[model samples]
Target: MASNTPAPEAPFDAFGGGAGPAAPDTEWNPTEGSLRAENRSGGRHRVVKQRSNFARSSTVLGVGVIAAVGAGGLATAQEKPPVAISLPDLPDMPDLGLPDAHDLPGVGALLPQENHETVAEGRANPNPLTVATYATDDERATKAERAEPVADVQAGAGDAGEALRARILQQAEQQQASADAADKAAAEKAAAEKAAAEAAAKADAAEKAAAEAKAKAAAEAKAKAEAEAKAKAEAAAEAERLAKLGASYSMPLSSYSLSATYMQSGSMWSSGYHTGLDFAAPTGTPLKAVHGATVKSAGWSGSYGYRIVLELSDGTEVWYCHLSSMTVSAGQTVGTGETIGRVGATGNVTGAHLHLEVHTAGGDGIDPAQWLRSKGLSL
Candidate 1:
């Protein structure tokens, strides 16, 4: 083996370790323009400046990794995912009733519903941002929705709204019908009551009128019956009285001609008129009594020559005037047709006649002819 290797020199000490003081050339100053400047002190030529484009291998790898991570963080910040919310299952809640159509302002039969199909479709993609695109206002999504043959979501909502509106209309109609029925019933009831009251009033009036008429008829009938009975009794009593007179009484003078009537106007007597009926007969004609009576007086009067007063049981006085003689004495009873006096013209007479006068008790004289007619005599 050839042995020609040079021995290595000992290392120099820079921090003053057994070496002499450092030379002025050992210090480095970068402020100078260049280390290879020309020797200005006329010393050995300035060491040539050494510069190397060098790098550490480990430091290069760390810088490359940091740059790549920063680029990835920038991209992640630009793109965001849909906000995902994990909600706990809601507890079974008590039923809180929804508001009625009338309870809300302008609700008008609208009902809310959940869109489960849209929610499920979003979850199937496993990408919240991809699913968010479906709900975006982008031109792509808007165009896709417009291209559909029939709008599914809008058609479903319209159908539900129409059904709710129809139901509301039906309910309104039912309520109106019920109200009308109630009104009609009330009106009919009022009319019936009015009719009943009118009928009752009419019935009362009719009853009162009928009762008045019946009472009037009864009173009239009673009065008529009483008058008829009174008339019949009077006629019967008169007939009985006349029948008694037919058996026991008669005309005062038979076969005599009637002369002056009672109450005849004349100036031949003192009283200026005739006061008794005159019967012209023979001077001795028999004069009979009209009825049974007692003789009250038989005497001579100035104008009557001889007179006899016969008083009947009822106090009626019968006077036989101008008599020539009287058969019955005073205070003597005589029957009907019996001779009570004789016809004669004894005083104040132009001819032989009999004058008869009838007088009621305490009253003036009456016509003998009328008195006889009352006793069932036609004359």
Candidate 2:
């Protein structure tokens, strides 16, 4: 068989050994397909590169998004909007009725429009309101007309305050004056009382002195009266005693004639002297003793026929000389007016008579007139 067919050249395998599976063709070629395949491979590489770049870009974008979110949260935490504060409006206040802004208490109104600007400014923006700007004529006039009662009240209050203060001071002064007057009056009264008391004491002393003087004068007068009375009584008693003695010693013969006197000179008697009184009578006429006495001698004497001598206690002797007879003997007591001898002319007698003689204690003849006169009897 030789046929001109080329024997299957032993199955001339393009793969060398036993083929387990069919091998891919190695020498196959397609022109447009190769080109297309090369293009497709390039396209696949480009696409993978693009996919990697896109993944990196996507990761960066996510990180940037997280940072932006974190920054936004931080900015929200750090910064905040300002809060607004609101206030309530104040309420309007009611006005108190007052005078216009220019007036003074007790004074006249001020000039017109004097404090308009100040008052307006103060009302709009009152810093510190004062009373000086209110004392204006226009304001006072306006206030007086509109608010007369308020103006009067303010004025009255001011006047009352001043008056009250003045009254208090005046009262204090009056009280002080009254107290001083009372003290002076009390002192004067005390002085007057003292003076009166002293005057009363002086008057009492004067009265006492007067009483004492009066008492002394009365005593003296009483003493003088008693002395005068005593003298008068003594004189009266002396007169009575004298009268009794004179009556007892009276002479018994009332009509006997005197023939011889005492102290007479005679020629017949010795020494020519007569020492006795003679009472002429007839013979045997009785003779008497002038007073009571004792007889000391009753005998005859030379030239005398008979005689009797009577002695008295007073040292006096009575002698009956030239008697007719002697009746009293010696040592015999004779009473007054008793018979002691008889009337006779004896002892150289010229005629018949009774002779009587008085002799002292010394035996001297004394005048019978003087002796008898001493015994409260008239000679």
Show the lowest summed lDDT stretch of 10 residues, model 1: 85-94
lDDT of 1 by residue, 16-108 (tens): 232222344453323344423534544333332222111111222233243223223333322332221111111111112322211222111
Deviation from native of the Cα of residue 119 in model 2, angstroms: 70
Which candidate comes out best when scored by TM-score? Answer: 1
Give the poorly placed runs of model 1, Cα more than 4 Å off: 1-134, 137-178, 200-208, 211-219, 254-269, 279-285, 313-315, 324-332, 345-353, 361-364, 367-378
| Residue-by-residue lDDT tens digits, candidate 2, 29-111 | 34566557868788421111112323322333343343233223233312332111111111111122333222222111211
Error of 1 at 298 (Å): 3.4
- Output the lDDT of residue 268, model 1: 86
What TM-score do all the candidates reach, one by one?
0.50, 0.37
lDDT at 137, model 2: 29
